[model samples]
Target: MPGQLFCFGFGYTAEHLAARLLPLGWKIAGTAREADKRAAMQAQGIDAHPFPLPDPAQALAGVTHILSSVPPRDGHDPVLAAHGGTIAALPDLVWAGYLSTTGVYGDAGGAWVDEDSPLNPSSPSGKARVAAEAEWQALDLHLHIFRLSGIYGPGRSAIDQLRAGTAKRIARPGQLFNRIHVEDIAAALAASMAHPNPGAIYNLADDEPASSSDVVSHASTLLGVAPPPEIPLEQANLSAMGRAFYAESKRIRNDRIKRDLGLTLAYPTYREGLAACLSGAVSN
Candidate 1:
């Protein structure tokens, strides 16, 4: 479709998504929290500006697509309180997406969860995300929610963790987690935008949901190094907030996105994805 798109809190995911969508003939605009980053975005051919966190009442004129990659706040997002109306009032906007977390489906004990699964978030951040998703869903707009899992890609993967000597296999029993390569996320998003599916919830995750230890062990094996010593979940010395995540166990399902958006993920599992990251493979 021929339209202008806006991405709020345009971080890593949005950056990669924008790079893909631009060449496909979509006009783009995005927010920057820093002045230097704004300049850098403009230099890289993005229409860069500061979009007030709680977006202002002023309309964005003709933006047809909007994606919010802003991580949910620790408790509540005041941005939603202030700018929800502004977002809801956009007349020309056709598709709006809220990036959330699968942690909202708290402690399923590795049972599978699809789009219609109940939300019982354990962490403060996850609870906040559930609330945010509610706000957008109630807006009567074309809304799609992406409950993302562990996000890893080029410079942000097991390789980085292993090389830095910070890769530890935390012995959290049944703490299965899902992940998606950055390229697959970008691809899934582009598919959604191109073929708008409002009021849809997509679990943006890979096919496999492996335990934390499994990932660490596989990553170490791939690197031809010994796995890091296992740290018991209780004695792991995690921050109070980090410990909250360790408290839950769940596995995400991405079948909805596959059936709806026709997404065949480039990296279907952490094993393939992490291997690609280590071997310098790119998504086609």
Candidate 2:
């Protein structure tokens, strides 16, 4: 059957997925944060609506697949608060996806974590995602929870940071993180749709995990620019939010996506992903 997708938050990751699915006989509809963006998406032939949707039932009219990139706000899921019942009642809805975060696993001391890892979030944002995942799972829908690591792609990668002179190389020893390109995220989501396994939780991350400073240095080398001088972790003046990222260190395992859904990451590491971003293969 031809698919109809309704994305609750048609932001960066969801947009990439829509780009892939639109040409394959998929009808896309979603909620955008701004009026101008909603108009723009409509011009692109999407059934886009304003967010905090006053009439979610209307927006959900013929949606067979639903994807939510909406993060929880103030300890509650906005989507579940507004239209959880409507979604539960939709008889023909085939799939629902929630974009979660690996932060829910808390600090693993640079150890690896998989889908079955325990939930122990260290930050408020991470805690909120954990709660949101549970709320979505409780709906008893054909739900797929994707726990993403650090997300970077296209205009959002380190190449953009280097060009803008905003890239930093904080030298925190043994601090490692896994990241997934947005395109890879879309591919994994698409694969899951083709092989729907309800109640599946997959980690959407690259095969290799590395320190932030190393990745920044690589981007600088690729751009032929002088890399930012490294500042020791203790000497770096970081905001609370930025420092929170340093408090956690985990190498996320992505074997489940490959094993279960047969998905392979187009960019298995930050090097390949940043290269693609610099080459104009992806747009902002």
| TM-scores for candidates 1 onward, in order | 0.93, 0.97
Model 2 bad stretches (over 4 Å): 282-284
CA-lDDT, candidates in order: 0.83, 0.90
- Residues 1-284, candidate 2: write the lDDT tens digits: 56999999889988899898988889999999899989988987889888878787787887789999998998989999989999998878999999999999999999999988899889888899999998998897999999999999988988999988788999989999999999999999999898899999999999999999999999999999889999987778888868888999999999999999898788999988999999978632
- Least accurate 10 contiguous residues by lDDT in model 1: 51-60
Clash tally for model 2: 0
Model 1 scores what on Cα lDDT? 0.83
Query: Candidate 1 residues 1-284, lDDT tens each?
Result: 56788888778998889889778788887788899998988887787768574335443557888888876565555446647777778888889888888888987877898789999988778888888788778788899888899899988988779999888789887788888899999998889988987888889999888887888899899999999889898778899777988887777889888998999999999888889889998885
C-alpha lDDT of residue 23 in model 2: 83
